[model samples]
Target: MKPAAFDYHRPDSVEEAVSLLAELGEDAKILAGGQSLVPMLSLRLAFFDHLIDISRLDELKGIERRGDALWIGAGTTDATVGADRQVSAAVPLLTRVTPFVGHFQIRNRGTFGGSIAHADPAAEYPTVALTLDAVMEAVSPRGRREIAAADFFTGLWETALEPDEVLTGVRFPLSNSRSGFGVHEFARRHGDFAIAGSVVAVRLEEDRVSHCAIGLMGLGSTPRRAAAAEAAVLGMPLGELDPKQIGELAMSGLDDVPADLQGSASYRARVGAVMTARAWTDAVAEAGGEATHA
Candidate 1:
C-alpha cells in the first residue's frame, strides 16, 4: 500500500515549521528522519494532510555536553549517537543499547527525537531515557519548556507533547565515576524487538548500593521503572543482596504486561526477571560492587 496524498512543506527554520503546524492544526505532521513515520504512512496506518519537513533544520542537529547533562539534538541519528565519544562517556547505557534498535540501516536514518516522540514501550531509547532521567525540550507558539523523562511519556506511542510542539533536543544527565549502567534484552533474532528486557544503573560507595535505577521493556504499556526493586536495594550492603531476588522484585510490581504471540504475560514476566538479574549483576560489577550470589 502507498501513503495517502499529502502536501509537503520543507521549512527553512523551526520557527517556520511551528508556524505551519499552528496553521495546519490536526492536519499537519513533523517529518524528521521519517524512519518511523514513513513506514506507517506507507502501510496506511496513519494519515496526515500536511508534512512539515524539518530534516534540514540546522538548529536541531548536534551533540555536546552542557553544564552537566549531554545535550543531543532531536535530529541526531542513532549511528552518530552510538559513535560519539562524549555520549559514550556521559551515558554509556545509551551507547550500549543503540545497536539493538533495529539493523544498522534503520539507525542510519532514525532520529533520536523521532524515537522518543514515537515512544514505543519496548524501544531501547525510551527505556534508557527513562532510566537515566533524561530531559526533553520542545518549542511551540507558547514558548519553550522542559519535560522530565518521567512525565514525558504518557501512554502507548503517546507523549505529553502538544500537537503544535516540536521536540528540539534531549539531555541525558552525566554519570559519576562510581556509577555503572547495563541494558539486556531477549529478542528472537539479532535485530528483532525484545521479548523482554531490563536496563539497570547502579552507584556504589563502601560496598553498599548508594543509587540505583531499573527500567523494564517489552513488559508493560509504557517504559517502566522497577520502582519496588530499586527501593529494595537502596543503602543495602552488597553481601546481603541477591541479584535474582532483585529481578523477581522487578517483576512483582508489573500489572499491565502485554500478552501476545511472542509469549504469555507469565512467560514475559519470567524473561523479564532473568534479564533484570543479568543486568543487575553486570551493573553492580561495573560499579565496583560485588553481586555475591552471581
Candidate 2:
C-alpha cells in the first residue's frame, strides 16, 4: 500500500524547517534519511499530510565537541557517525552498535536524529542513548529545549517532541574513567530488527567497577534502562557478579515490559537478562584484571 497523499516541503535551513513544521502542525512529518519513515509510509502504517524535508539544512549537519561532550547533528547519517574516529573515541557506544542498525545502504541514509525522534522500541540508537544518558536538542516556534534520552521516549513509536518541534542534534557526554562499552543483539537475519539487544557501558576507577549503565531494547514498550541491574554491578568485581544474581536484577526492572507476537513478556524478559549479563561479562573482561568478583 502506498502512503496517503501528502505535501513535500524541503527546507534549506533549520529555521525554515521549523517554520514549515509549525505551519503544517499535525499534518506534517519530518523527513530525514527516510529509512524508517518511508517504509512506514509505504505500508500505510503512518499518515502525514505534509513532509518537511530537512536534508538540506546545513546547520543540522555536523558533528563537533564542546568540553567533554560530543554534539552530533540530527541530520547526520548513521554511516557518517559510525565512521568518525572522534565519535568512536568519545562515545564508543555509537560506534559499536551503528553497524547493526541496518544494511550498509540503509545506514548511508539513516539519520541519527531521525531514529531518536521516531522512537522505535527495537532501534539500537535509542538504547545507546539511554545507556549513555544523552540529551536531545530540539527547536520549534516556541523555543529551543533539551530532553533527556531517558525521558524522551514515552512509548513505542512516540516521543516527547511536540508537533512543531524539530530535533536538531544529540549530545553525548565523555566518560571520565577507563570506560568500556559493548552492544549485543540477536536477529534472525543480518539486517533485521533485533529480537533482543543490550548496550552496556562500564566505567572503572582504579581497577574497580565505579559506574555501570545498561540499556535494553526489544524487551519493553520503550528502550529501557536497567536501573536495578546497573546498581547490582556497580562496585562489584566483574567475576563476582554471578549470572543468576545479574539475571535477577536485570529481570527485576522489566516488570512492565509488553508482550507481542514476536515474543512473550516472559521470553523477552529472559532475553533481556541474558543479553545484559553477557554485556556485563564482556565489559568486565575489557577492563583487564581490574574487574573483581566476590
The TM-score of candidate 2 is: 0.95
RMSD over all Cα atoms, model 2: 1.8
Please, what is the whole-model Cα lDDT of each candidate in the order they appear? 0.93, 0.83
My TM-score estimates for the predictions, one after another, are 0.98, 0.95
RMSD of each: 0.8, 1.8
- In model 2, the Cα lDDT at residue 35 comes to 94
Model 1 worst lDDT window (10 residues): 285-294
Task: Look at candidate 1 and give me any clashing residue pairs.
Answer: none
lDDT of 2: 0.83
Per-residue alpha-carbon lDDT of candidate 2 for residues 14-88, written as tens digits (9 for 90 to 100):
889889988888988899999999989999989999998887788888999977799999989999999999898
Write one digit per residue (lDDT tens) for candidate 1, span 1-294. 899999999999999999999999999999998988999999999999999999888899999989988999999999999999999998999999999999999999899999999999999999999998999999999999999999999999999999999999999989998887888999899888889999999999998999999999999878999999999999999999998999999999688899999999999999999999999999999998776798
Each candidate's number of clashing pairs is 0, 5
Candidate 2 local Cα displacement, residue 35, angstroms: 1.0
Best by lDDT: 1
